[model samples]
Target: AQASFSQVFMGVAFTCGAEEEVIPFFDRGLPVEYELTRSIRVVAKTNRKKIGVLNTEAKLFGGFDFQSMRSTPPWPVVDELKKQYDVEQVSASEPIEEEYDALLIALPSSLPQKEMDHLQDYMEAGNPTLLLVDPLTIINVGLSPSEKAGANMNPFMRNQGPPPKEKGDIHALMTALGVSWNKAQIIWDQYNPHPDFAHLQPEIVFVGANNPEAFNQEHTASAGLQELVLLFPGSLRKAADSDYDFQPLVKTTPASGSLNYSQLVQRSFFGVQLVQPRFGHRPNPAAYTMAAHIKGESFPDTTNGADSDTTQTPTRVNAMVIADLDFISQQFFQIRQQAVGNLNFDNVTFFLNCMDVLVGDESFITLRKKRVRHRTLETIEEKKREFREEQLKEEQEAEAEASQALAEAQKRLSEKVAEVRQRTDLDDRTKEIMARNLQEAEQRKLDALKNKIEAKKEARIQRSKEEMEAKIRSIQSNIKVYSVFLPPLPVLGFGIFIFVRRYKREKEGAAAARRLRA
Candidate 1:
């Protein structure tokens, strides 16, 4: 069965690569092969550790594919972690092994509150648990009759509860970890002026804040993460009463935003606007709080179970929350191609980065490349950054080379001057004549050295001037390139996209008619 599956996989892989350029494929493929080999070696070094992945089943999630639900899988990193660590996926319905070192909970909010309650003991016993709070809804027993309308509303109502009080009871557990979900908040970036998003909508960019004691550089998961993507609108913030330190992972823009529950579910009649925009009537430019981390004193178990006698321990827990649910929707990924500044997959990368941190792997962060648009202004900025880096390197090399050259020249001149001074076999008059000639030669040598020094300085100065001129020229050229295409590059890309789409559809129809006739 394994051999058969491998064959099929190889076939699919080859078919996908069939149309790719052969030279490019080999160039890219060779390096990837070596990377995989190195990764395998690293895994071999680790003692197998168990990593529990808690997710909702299809029945509970309305036929959702639990394994395939995430915007990006944490499996790659988890598998790597397993090489040094044992990895396992625990279902919401399954019992957790007491021997497991770390637990990762990635499930919808509709999970039973009892499960979270059950895990409280393990959490308090110093085991690490990573929680991913689904976009908005959470699992709770406080669900009302109207809230449990169907599969669609069941989790939302069950987890989030009713109006007026937006924050859920999940805060009770999160409080132990010094983290609580900010149910009403949303991250929005008001500074987006890209042509596609300008008239359509404002993109949301979240920010992270540090909490010193709980989240220092020691923990691999929280290491080097500046910001996390807002998968949901709601966020996590530090609680007042908890002893553990809390740190922000995702944040909102400083655009006069709010966590008003009324605005989130505005009821509209006809075409009149109902709720005011969250950023208000004007614009602002600061980052707001969203996701957070807690690294100490997770919980105290007050359970009636048989394991109630287990000694209390100060455990660590990491949790992330995003308010908006639609951020992870397939529609968002599909429509992203139409956005300006080549904004496609920005959010996707953010999600993968979060998973990488949680799984303690740096590969995802290192492997991904930042997309650069072909716009003139953007190109100028790119060139400037590249040129500055090259210039600094060249300057360092030139300085070292100049110093070495000066040392060599000085050594030779000193030796020559000493040799000339030693000639005393001639008569006084001859000696004097030879002395004057030697003096003239020595002076010439000194002059040459001085000129060389000055030349090096001038060369450096000239290089700087050239660089400045080049930067200015690049900026002007970029302006001209974009100006030739009036409004923006996104508009041009969109027009071309539409034209190609229409042409493909027409060709497909003609081909189908021909096949039918044949």
Candidate 2:
């Protein structure tokens, strides 16, 4: 207050390290106060805990791809880390050195023996780490070698999921961390229904752990998280009689089911399955763990080579494992905050909290990401939202049904083509010609079918939408009129009544006074 009003002031000053890159505090991932404090601390102590990000096929740190003809930037999460720590991509093939305070391994798979040993040693040493591995992600299938070289791989494209070989223990680091992830199964949460195929169906395949109770409320990493969206996440459970305690961080309600890995990845087969609920019938009801810590008693026991005959000793596995990578990917968590820079969920906050937990520094965990607040008309929006969701779900179900039909038709056509191609009587040219004709025919038929289904869906949705829109418009119009003029009507009426009563009372008093004088 004194400085604001008076001339006396202490000039502000901050020192930057000789090697550290200096930038405005706004770009620093921490809150202004924390960033100022951290900057002050850096002047005295230049050393900061390093955070290593092992790049996967997804290419976390993107660059201009000559092949894809696109320039991509690092994800917001990674960019934030770079501003605060010595963030760099670490290779799995190399020895795990640099003494990273925390390591984030995404899409890990098979590992070389040497890398495996290094990773095992690193985890056993009580380093905080987070692992995100997926068996079948709908995001984009693995990018082409050339495209990945350019670092412009798009994950949202519909294509075949990663091949078995690309998943060399999927970062080959998951196995080393003692985090058991099944490269074969994916969870399908039924309670929080977000169906992938909007086909006409009663069953849903998309997984969403949307309840607060499903989160480990006591843990700082997951506390206050109301929901987590996972596409096809695997369950985190103890591996085959392994006693290592699996403390769950995120869980699915009993209404969750597991889908077949191979069948789900193949588009046609998966679409067909979506059309028909195979897993939905069995309806396995268990609170499956989607994310957890592999630590304490459940840690794998290892015996020193010199003492082979001795009993194995347990080591703390200070690691947190999340089954799906998309939850943290730019598409899922950072979607809403992209354009408007407001009204985002706690996804990024959850990630930041996990990072702080792993890095053993809670300094920035309480600070939220950049956000802008605005007012919304709740009365109108509430009704509109209800209608909009219903309409979207209906449309999706219709699309799912259309997709299933197309898949079946294509499957039949493919089987027939395979049978025809096997015949040796026809020359290569004839076979090629037949194949082309059949594909053309298949395209025409599928397009017609898709159009037919789409038309129907649009017509139905339009009708429902029109009806709802009319009702909403009527309600809104009424609300507007009432809001404009109805607010003061009661007050106005009450004032008139009070005036009339007062007038009557005063007239009676004057008449009585006059009668007394006469």
Q: What is the TM-score of each candidate against the true structure?
A: 0.46, 0.57
Candidate 2's displacement at residue 38, Å, is 5.1
Please name the candidate that would achieve the greatest lDDT relative to the true structure. 2
Q: Model 1, 13-106: lDDT tens per residue? A: 2112222111112221122443344345444444434666565421322233222343433333343344344566566444455566556554
Candidate 2 local lDDT, 104-174, one digit each (tens): 87654434345545666667777777776665544443331111221223334324345323223332345
Of candidate 1, the 10-residue stretch with the lowest lDDT total is: 138-147
| lDDT of candidates 1 onward, in order | 0.47, 0.60
State how far residue 296 of model 1 sits from its true place (Å): 1.9
Instruction: List the candidate 2 regions with Cα displacement exceeding 4 Å.
Output: 1-13, 16-21, 25-45, 61-76, 94-98, 110-121, 134-140, 143-166, 170-217, 222-295, 299-310, 323-347, 369-518
Q: After aligning candidate 1 to the native by TM-score, how far in Å is the CA of 106 from where it should be?
A: 3.9
* RMSD over all Cα atoms, model 2: 9.9
